[model samples]
Target: MTFDGSWAEGREAPPAPDAPDGPVRATTSGETRRWLRPPWVRLIVLLVAFVLADTVVGGIDQGLDDVPVVGLPVGVVLAALVLFAYVKAIRFVEHREVAELARDGAAADVRRGTLIGIVLFLACIGIIAMFGGYHAGWGSIGAMLTTFGLMCAVAAAEELIFRGVLFRIVEEMAGTWGALVVSALIFGALHLVNPDATVWGALGIAIEGGLMAGAAYAATRTLWLPIGLHLGWNFAEGGIFGVTVSGSHGTVGLLKGTLSGSAVLTGGNFGPEASLVAILICGIPTVVFLRLAARRGRIHPRPRRASAAAAEH
Candidate 1:
């Protein structure tokens, strides 16, 4: 037996070095993973939620006619509730608070862009009228107000769902290009449900409406810009000029008119969405914004294995 601790075989072994200890981040936030779910899963969940909300509201409006004493104002209230539920549900599924993710600067930029876009749209309308739109009776002030309010609400709801939720989710999973193409196709496809929708209409939407909306979202990082653009385009197309919107004409409008010539130019039965002019109107800005966004990094990145591992460790 050796007398000293190091006497074994007249040699000593080196002590093991300490393992690296670092922070470990979670792969998920542990909520519902709404955005991380398979594409079909997310789509189905959204479709079901929308249908359920619609059905419930429709039933209530019909069943309790006298509930509000005057009128239920069901459309307005339902719109608000639907918007709230959509925001809440998306947040819940993502397990991330929008307040935390939202950039104040981005929001401010979106608001500014929205205002500018609205002004540009109004200018466009004036220019179109000057060119030769048949201006008939300017409808009632009340009707105009109602039309504007409804259009704004509808725009907000659609923009929130498409750009805010679906676009964001796809961007998170599939990267920027994937998100743009996928969201655009789906957005265009959705319009096919409208009356008088045609192949041209669908393609035009994919390029003009869908791509423009996505680009605005990517650039602004807030739904406000897209919402305002959507609202203005629809109102200008339908309310101001008496053209169809999504192939449906409103009951009341600010003005009644016919496009001077050629449905190909003015959108004909499919409205502005099917016109080549519309593509030029929407596509230019869309491509510009997309280029800017790609430069700015507003499009979120898909998690790579190396990055994910580093994040986890």
Candidate 2:
């Protein structure tokens, strides 16, 4: 008996019609199985990485507290490194090479986001001032620089996790509206740990922090814009205005403004981020940005496995 030369190992060779049946050999498919991680699993990995980075950095910063002016810069560098690692790790795990994550006109995106954030925050404060809820005073330069550094680190870190990881993953899995709701709620819930946090404050954060930032990402598909917006909002609120941000005390501010009005309008001790006026101010842009994203086809669709199978029929 002669064997067929066309039979390859690990592949199911078709039964040769010319061969008289004696003993037939069976084989399995040659295709190698690869485990594709779902979006949610990737999101969990990103969150864990974030927590680890924050904890390690916090410990290091604590040790350097005795040194003057060194702790902040060191912490900033470490935080940036963590973000870089996160982006790299995610790219590897997802089997994608996203050059845009590194390049893609980052400077322009960040500048636009910063301008929008500053303008929106200033408008919120201006509205408060108009309503006699604000009193202005002067602050120190050292404090401003320190606050800027800290806020930049924070803005970059949070935006990477929320907009870069969670929002992006969820958008791919659940589409735009689903991502908007889930990300916004999670964002607001995270702020509940802050001092003097309130329900309305959390709700305000859900809309402004969650939805607005997600929309920003949806429009540009880059982290820089959200990071810049977050940096500007926090800096303008606490660093410039000298008001508490999410119930945290400000180190210093250029304007020593005192807010005194209804907590709903003034944002109470949680700063203007929790104010009703903030929701209104941020909501308009959120709508506009999301609309732009939709028009540009930037809003991603749900995974196509089931739909593709259906189409095959």
Candidate 3:
């Protein structure tokens, strides 16, 4: 299916005042051609925007962490800024209005995603508990609040970087499957820097984090669902359950839990994100979401320069 460029309304040239005695042609020789940017160029611009936003927000996060009783508020503000920056960047670089990031039904989508994430994590915990790998108890409220703030920052940042930027651009370049594979692998590889990160953990993260989150975006065509899912998972795993998250410390949580068993089942220090149970549980919903996306024709076809050029003439 060819995109006839009609989607970018108002950018097209108006009809000539002195009409020519011929069929109207939208040729590529003038103003219309200027908007044609390659996907790679857009990707580069997106990366630059992401880095700038991250650097600025990271500094703010660090500063806020130093202050007492202000981390949550600071994190909330920074997360909002990061999301705004991402949406603005996408709109500017894509040269079109990004309506997919709209907030009309965002609350519903977020609630749905959050519920799914909580359920999936609960299943992982349940499986581990059955295997004598988890014992749960409570922790301090202050710690839980701090972890919630931090997890919100991490979730918003990652979803913007991975699903919002990388997955979106790569999909335009290489189609949906290509986007899924490339984005997922990169997401997994990025976690290698975490303490106790193993090859298995990375692979697990690829399936659970990358594919699952990308699938969420594909199904909804919005960032809110994926953001909610990511936020929910990390907050539940670390903030609530008091487990390691991607081989990093949980810092503070509501429920304290000890995990002991085979690394395959327990995910070791990398948390449930690396466990086989997580993959199985999360994979089901991921597959379902991808199928829904396919059914809805949400999977974009790769752009063809030849077709585009033909359309121009």
Clashes of 1: 0
Model 1: per-residue Cα lDDT over 144-199, one tens digit each: 44555555556656666677666766765676677788888988988888788987
TM-score of each candidate structure, all chains considered together: 0.71, 0.81, 0.83
Give the per-residue lDDT digits (tens) of candidate 2, residues 212-283. Answer: 888877765667778878878887886688888888764356666678988878999888888989999999
> Residue 91 deviation, candidate 2, in Å?
2.9
For lDDT, the strongest prediction is 3
Which has the better TM-score: candidate 2, or candidate 3? 3
Residue clash pairs of candidate 2: 137-256
Model 3 clash number: 0
lDDT of 2: 0.71
- What value of lDDT does candidate 3 attain over all alpha carbons? 0.74
Model 2 lDDT-worst window of ten: 20-29
Instruction: Name the TM-score of candidate 3.
Output: 0.83
- The model with the greater lDDT, 2 or 3, is 3
